[model samples]
Target: MKRALPLLIFMAISGAVFSQENPIGIFEDNKDIGNPKLAGSASYDETSQTYTIKGAGYNIWGQRDEHRYLYSKVKGDFVATANFEFEGNKEIHRKIGWMARASENDNSVMVGGFLHGDGLMAGQWRERKGADMQNPEDDVWAQKRYQQIIQLERRGNTFIVRAAHPGEPLQEISSKQLEFMPEAVLLGVVIGSHDENVIETARVWNARIDQPVAEDYNPGKDGWIGCRMETMNVFDGKRRVIHEKDGRFEAPNWMPDGKELLFNEDGSLYTIPINGGKTEKLNTGSADDLNNDHCISFDGKMLGISHNDGEGSNVFYLPLDGGEPKSVTQQAPSYLHGWAPNNKEVVYVAQRGENKVYDIYRKPIKGGKEVKLTDNKKWDHADGCEYSPDGKYIYYNGSKNGGTMQIWRMKPDGTEKEQITFDQYNNWFPHISPDGKWIAFISFSPDIELNSHPSYKKVMLRLMPTSGGAPKVIAHLYGGQGTINVNSWSPDSKHIAFVSNSKKSVKVD
Candidate 1:
């Protein structure tokens, strides 16, 4: 179906006022290219922080092509991401997504992380001007007609394409080395009809362009980085960075009231307004050296903290309002992760006695002998264990293949253990939702070592049903250790709080 472009209405939105001189001020520049009967338009919705674009042009294919493009000029390496979908099923080949081009000419060399109207999502590229189109091998193809989370990045000469359904991690769909391409080029969202006479409309929401470090770059050592407290809607996969700081902060614990977040920095725990604000320290008396492992009990009366007490790590309980901490687990190297529903017991991962092997243990808050739930061999280790909301099972991560770490669940008594997740990456921290209907966990890259959960890597926060199913990536971020060490799901289970790190001065309220 064809539509008139001029009839499309474009609205400017943001905390900053946008005028004719500041068209889509978020980007360096943009244009609706290709001669068409109707001009394309872009609109921003302040409430949702989303962009809507309507355009008309011929197919962006063949020896040469035409299409309405919304672009920004950029130089050097960059990462661009957006959640996109067409306005309607106007045409089967209608295309919309992130694009990187060497030039605006129809025959320009380019690569696209695209979602097509026919539900054919692909990473398509043109090697050079007027060249034949080529796509990645079969291993990377994925499809869906609805909204897609697309990411396109350029690292040196390598062009990497990633995309996925919202609430899922972006999978690497295509990668190509374009050595001849210029250091600077045009990049942004694009729309095309696949037929010159036809006009198609679409949207690219929460679009972000990140200037990241080299793949070999090690953050902090190479350069100091800041952190952002981020929350995502579990159902829609919409993300918002609620707070940011000049230095690193880790392990967000959403308060029971949902009005604030508890995070740790410089060995001290602090609370910040959920909407973003100044940080105030929470006194723990003499228990300092707090790590990222911390959680609020189901009753919301006490906080379980993993504190380094000079001897080593141990679990401690303190009043939610901040007071003298009471030691719960006297065993050193014990990292507290979850609190039982009754709030009388705490689950932790520790290397007790001379074992030197980490395993899940259930320790009574009132003091009792620790119960070891895993007695696997020396090569085996377990971590990220927490009681199910219903208090029937304890979910944790273990190497089911004796190499690849998979999510596992067992009775609280350590019986009937079974693997719940089977995939490429090392999945950890299975934090069940308050309602017990969903499970959220952190997933490391497949290239990472089997047992290590390191920081400063590209990782995915994924979601799945509590009963078990294929997991979906909810957030792609540069974080690991401090990202999600505890159950951070909101009380209502509609949202989740986590942390992301970056060297850039990106700010979002």
Candidate 2:
């Protein structure tokens, strides 16, 4: 009996330790805050990359609170986001969202963006430890509801909350400056049931933590941030991360066969299975100074690249299976962006003569007079030129006299130019899908310069009908420049591959 008792005690201790271990997604630990009458639990499902949190608490209001928290310590500025959906039982006041707290104590000072069971979206906070929670009445909380995704960001001592529905742009809900908050604090997802006796369950997914770079940070002079390779379903707006790297990688090009994706890292091209496995470097032979401006031919038999030639970039082509690259353009500074449907010619952006203005041009691969497609002299700028699937139009980003950049399409000869996007944001790189029904593009915030698409910035991947309509946001991520510089749509036109950045490095696998 003594031996059995000792074994039982050991098992209980082991179970408790296992519960505290942090093996799930991005969290460091999972535990209940305030110790509710009924214990709370948190779990992660690897298959779906989803988090399920069941919590019992009287409420996350008034002095002292109870909830389940899956958290890690973060210092300085950071942004956290998650999509939440409550399940089973419901109470109007039950809450689920992203949180930043001063400590683990139930009455600690905290601020968060939350969604209530009855479709209430708000930013709630406690200014001081052991103080009652303050929401709409004390601040500018969102009155309208039905938002399922919540984001919380901290800059210095100020915290802001933003919420949005799937496939929509996030709208600011509220902001608060907590002067007493420390530089380092607990940041994670939290769940609470308004009634202590009732346990509420909620599923959370697409949780992300990103740390923004300084205003003057330079990716080339400074260093690059971690990269996340992701593919998203165009119809349902669901994203699946295929791989992550601690350093820089950019501009994923979906192979025509749809079995793998190719991207550039450290001036070398590499390929990885779409589902992510071993990363194999593509043989570029002597042409290794490649940039993000690389794409696969429509027929899937050729690869086009922009390699740095001493002073500037030049277009080159090689077999998709990798071999010695053959020069396509003698002009330095020429960047390959698209290939003609005939496969005998390629489209690029370059400067010629005394104009010195970057414009779209088409040249035969076998050597011929390069035909200029855009005449954006004066102060106008043009780049990211690509041909539509049927070769009916050439899509590109352009600005008139240093104005806001927007997607524009023109005929093969650069005639009948027409603006396709009318948003205030700066849109760049319009990639037409394989089916020619949809156009995917990246948009930078309106605050950014009209002619600049810098790296390590807040951007959105948006989708719109090729025929034209309002564009809907598919993904909001911290990336720019190399995020989607080339055509990345799967052969079926159902998914797209792109890269996002984060300060926190993730597991390579």
Candidate 3:
């Protein structure tokens, strides 16, 4: 009996930690043990990627009564995040945050990192089954404030909670140990109305769930997992995932008519509805090996493609509606980036000299000798080069004086070279919006090498005024390479489209 007891305990712990039955997507609202009269509603916004929970419950503490829960059943270590807030003025105790619990029971063993309407944020929990919840161990309490970014991470047997205001990273607030809770538990966005008769809905935005991965995991051999095609309302801070797939897709460019989005998958180009639907193959005739570096001209009448399947990249021009592609650049390793204001000339980055230096070059659409715009002494690497909207300047990214890559711009005539951004992080692809009011670019962390922007790393999409100013983070995502290789700003200049990756582990249902 003694030997058998130890074996039984080990098996029980193993089952809790490594269960494969996980629901790995957005979920609506459901009650644990609440009054049938107290209703709750939940929804996920496909445009802004926000979640809302309209819940009515007395309280989630003090042995529990009624509340709404929207959760995913995850078994292994994971990180969950949300921007949490209440709809309007309400009672001080109205709560909404993130939770991890063993079950939906009213008195289930659980821990919650929640924010109260009265401006109190806490890490509350129940020690035993059906036990009354204890006070949180938060170091400080606010009288009334909303935590815009809330994160809950499970590291082995310990759970850590953190929250911060918008445009800021989550900072640690509290940590708890719940060794008794099952390893396979429900954890996600949570909300409680506090007053069962009056449902003060809770709002959450940028809901993300990242599963644990090895430090050296390879996406090619391990295979890519979940990918979401997302759009962002740059002005209002709203984002949503419109389409999700099991593998990889790259660089979505808004269609000319604004009815669809064109992206690259495998080695071909495809178009899906602007919002999301069945994707149709955009036949490029013989240009089957198109890369993500493709874009439409200002007049929206022509398309440029960079085909890099065989030896080196070949730049081609074709009709916007897809037709027989005509070769544009005579060089072997040229990439198409931008078109002149009148659509009469095309600009790209290519190797022109015996040094194999990557520099900006321009060629007339009606057939002319290629003109090199940038003539520097060293640094064989310069990329993300493109022409400004009005054709006044050419924006590109490269390191100067052997420093970090900075956003630089020069006159279309290749004179008056100047730097735009000077920061510690390596920035790339200074894409100008339609109205020419803002510049959206991708930034990699300082820890990474200056010349590398690898895939599946934590990266940020930052926006700055085109004239130049402080950059603000518009989106924090787990994507690189295919996220935004080309200009994807909508025609109205209100939104931008990009791609983010994830390793989804979904339940079979």
Candidate topping lDDT: 2
Point out where model 3 deviates above 4 Å. 1-25, 33-50, 56-66, 105-112, 121-144, 154-164, 167-183, 194-198, 351-357, 375-381, 503-505
Ranking by TM-score: 2, 1, 3
lDDT of 3 at 77: 67
lDDT of 3 by residue, 135-164 (tens): 543123433356676778777777888777
Tell me, by TM-score, which candidate is best. 2
Candidate 2 global CA lDDT score: 0.83
Query: Which of 2 and 3 is the better model by TM-score?
Result: 2
lDDT of 1 by residue, 1-509 (tens): 00000000011122222112324635544566556566777777755667788887776766565677766666677777778878777788888888888876778788787788887777777777778664333114565535478888888878898877766556687887876677777777888887667778887775666555455555435544566677888888777766766566788899999899998887789999877778889988898888888889999999988889988888899999899899987768888889999999999988877777788899899889899988866768798899988999999988733688789999999999998888888898889999999999999988876577766567788999987689987777667778887789998999999977643332211
Better of 2 and 3 by lDDT: 2
Task: Please report, as a residue range, the 10-residue window in candidate 2 with the lowest summed lDDT.
Answer: 1-10
| Candidate 2 lDDT for residue 418 | 96
Q: lDDT per prediction?
A: 0.76, 0.83, 0.74
Clashes of each: 3, 0, 6
Task: Compose the digit string of candidate 2's lDDT tens values, residues 1-509.
Answer: 00000000000011221234664567877888899988989898876678999998888878887998888776678778778899975698899999888888888888889898888888888888987665455446586787988899888989999999988998999898998787777788989998989899999987888877777766556666677888888887767778886677889999987899999888899999998889999999899889889988888899999998786789999999999999898887798899988888999988888887788999998789999988887778788888898999999999998789999999998799999999899999999999999999999999985577877677889999998789998887778878888899999999999988754432210
Root-mean-square deviation of Cα positions for candidate 2 versus the true structure, in angstroms:
8.8
The list of candidate 1 runs beyond 4 A from truth reads 1-26, 34-38, 59-78, 103-108, 129-147, 165-173, 194-199, 206-216, 400-402, 476-478, 503-509
